[model samples]
Target: MLLKDKIIVVIGGEGLLGKAIVNGILHEGGVPISADIKPIKDSNNDIDYIMVDITSKKSINDCIEIVYKKYGKIDALVNTAYPRNKNYGRNFLEVEFEDFCENLNIHLGGYFLTSQQFIKFFLKQGFGNIINFSSIYGVIAPSFEIYAETTMTMPVEYAAIKSAIIHLTRYMAKFLKGKNIRVNCISPGGIMDKQPINFIKNYNSLCLNKGMLDKDDIIGTVIFLLGDISKYINGQNIIVDDGYSL
Candidate 1:
């Protein structure tokens, strides 16, 4: 087992990606902790589950303490929490200040604070892995105004914040080098979820023009990063976009 007996934390654990990661960790024999603002349906008394608001410093610190209290040390932290901004649709102009800030806050501030709390433990123990979520959109510009058949579309702040997160992962990886802590990112393509009508219409058009991806496409990358095979692969952003950017 790659992560046998290791304690891992998956932030945004209530979401689809988070739940998938949690299950993967469990399958690998690692103790996966589900950390989120909302409790998941699978959250039980035996397994570790924490309530944390990534945007709040106090809440993050408290959750860190809870993790430390439950498990002696934290082996890894995978942040997959993202801002809820689909309500803006394709209208980039309608994306408000609060919405933008909220998205950026979790992608940037959340990673900084959460890593800050855990790095202390990692530094002391001399072993930790931080896996952040980036997006293929971070690497390639979104088709804001690409003329398909006859329409235009976009996803604004999400791509912006995800790009910022890639840099943050690099910074953390370089800063924690030789301390036995590693930082990396997973930049996945659009997940196959039942998105809103506007998003679906736009995405389908984009897919027809470009291509689409399935959720399972990310599984191999997730396993590789979480396992011991990637011990030396630090401070890198791996893009699993199925040539969406190509």
Candidate 2:
């Protein structure tokens, strides 16, 4: 019960990683409010989610108001929404300038909007926590060889967006100096998402152990951040990649 009774909002609670994080929070005795455009399965309807479009300022503000009124105080905000256009995920060479910009605006811009809106709420409450998602790709360049026989290619837009998030976390943390608000990021290694066998094999070979992380593997880090154990750990990017980046 490390997070006993804490009211934490998971921004992308409907997504793969987001759902896992929410479950982990519940296991630790935290009350997690799912804030996503798509509601989680069933989601208890009324109390399950705070439906939101993170890209829209009004939607985010509404989400804040709803959660605050219901939960009284929001302890932490974990952002994992992966909003992107259909043109996204193209290879670097095939990525048009317009497509790249649009994806960035949708994904990265949404992150900015959510963080800004939440910080305003946190300020009024006197304390808050913000945990953002980055990736191994954000910390280091993609390994193109892993995708040789697969259709999977790292998108340029993803790199730019994730890397930018790292800096934005730091900027927000410093900007809120002595304000009792903490900002941090988690840069995870590749998770086991049923990708091509060749890619998985190549990726595993790079890691020291556990070639690819399970969703549960990342949960501990997030839980740690949400608890008082990491009170002093602010504006830092914790990489949970099993030495994959090494």
Candidate 3:
């Protein structure tokens, strides 16, 4: 019941991580609103869904308007949306320069616009919380050795965007000081989806305990950051990598 009666807006609510965060908020007795470019199918009725294009300032502003119109106030915002172009996942040498810039425009630019709009609303309301997502890659370079045999290699754009997010969180936290708003980031290690066995095995070997993370492993951090318990916490990047970086 950490977030009981609170209203939280989750961008990219249809993605795997976003869905887990939505469920986590509900479990904590908070109202979770899902905002994305597409609608979620077979979603719970308790969750509110809003369509938004983070790349557009109007769309971002409209999203905030919709949330305020319905809930009167937004207690927190969790930005997990990463809209990538078709050229994503390309290997280092295979990656095209235009594709890299496009990915940044859609992903990092989107986060910036959405956050800018919400911070204005938060300013008016006198308080707000923002939780941004980063990756363990942001903290340390990807171990190229891990993906040796697999078709997967860390995309250059991903590393750039995630690293930027961490600094952006710190910048926002400082800019919003004395305005009763807090901004923090979560840098999660690799989440265990159905990756190739070789990749999984290689990744797990570097971890302190379990190799890859389950989606549920990150929910508790989300809840804690969004709740009153973290009132004193701001401008921090909390890494949840299970010691993989070590």
Candidate 4:
């Protein structure tokens, strides 16, 4: 049991990757509390689900209060929330400046707000851990050629937000030095969500092994960082892109 008896709160716990992390934490004996924008029916009696909007300070603070009240002490925080504006995912040329700012404000801004509140709590608690999610594109240039005939294109705003997350991890780790607080980032390649066949073909060609990873593939890293084994591992970006960034 890597995380036995620990209380781990996963923001965006209703998402694709967040769900896997929740299940993985349970498998390793940790108590997981799901914080998402919308409520999800509890399929498992072990999980404590709560409605949270990462974009709002009141919402985030309330979530922390609720989790702390129930769990007593929070051991780690896992952020997978990717809030976006309605006009998110537009092509570069079509993306307006306002839309770009809004996307970053929600996604990256939310991460900052939530982390800030948690870090404050952690400071008083004497220890804490934060795992932020980035993307492989944050580390390398976009493989635009892959989208050749597909209707999909990597949103420019996505790169800005994700890349900022990577550096933010480093900044937080350094800023929180000697506080027993840890901050780290994970950069995963294209996860195996349904996509155009041609795009998949192109993506696979650039990868070393698997073309795209599943949500479960990231759980091991999350478990490690949350557990004591990664006590010294902080301020680093762990890439799980199947070598796609290489």
- Worst-scoring 10-residue span by lDDT in model 2: 39-48
Give the root-mean-square deviation of each candidate in angstroms.
3.4, 1.2, 0.8, 0.9
Task: Residues 34-139, candidate 3: write the lDDT tens digits.
Answer: 9989777876788999898889998888888998899899999999997989989998898899999999999998988888989999999999999999998888
Rank by TM-score, highest first.
Answer: 3, 4, 2, 1
lDDT of 2 by residue, 88-137 (tens): 99989999999999999989999999999999999999999999998978
Better of 2 and 4 by TM-score: 4
Those runs of model 2 whose alpha carbons end farther than 4 Å from true positions after fitting are: 44-47
Counting clashing residue pairs in each candidate, in order, gives: 0, 0, 0, 0
Candidate 2, after superposition: displacement of residue 240 in Å?
0.8
TM values, all candidates: 0.85, 0.97, 0.98, 0.98
Error of 1 at 220 (Å): 2.0
Tell me the RMSD of model 2 versus the true structure: 1.2
Q: Between which residue pairs do clashes occur in model 3?
A: none
User: At residue 229, what lDDT does model 2 achieve?
Assistant: 93
Among these predicted structures, which one has the highest lDDT?
3
Q: CA lDDT of each candidate?
A: 0.78, 0.91, 0.92, 0.91
Against the correct fold, how does model 1 do in TM-score?
0.85
Candidate 3 lands at a TM-score of 0.98
Pick by lDDT: 1 or 3, better one:
3
C-alpha RMSD of candidate 3: 0.8
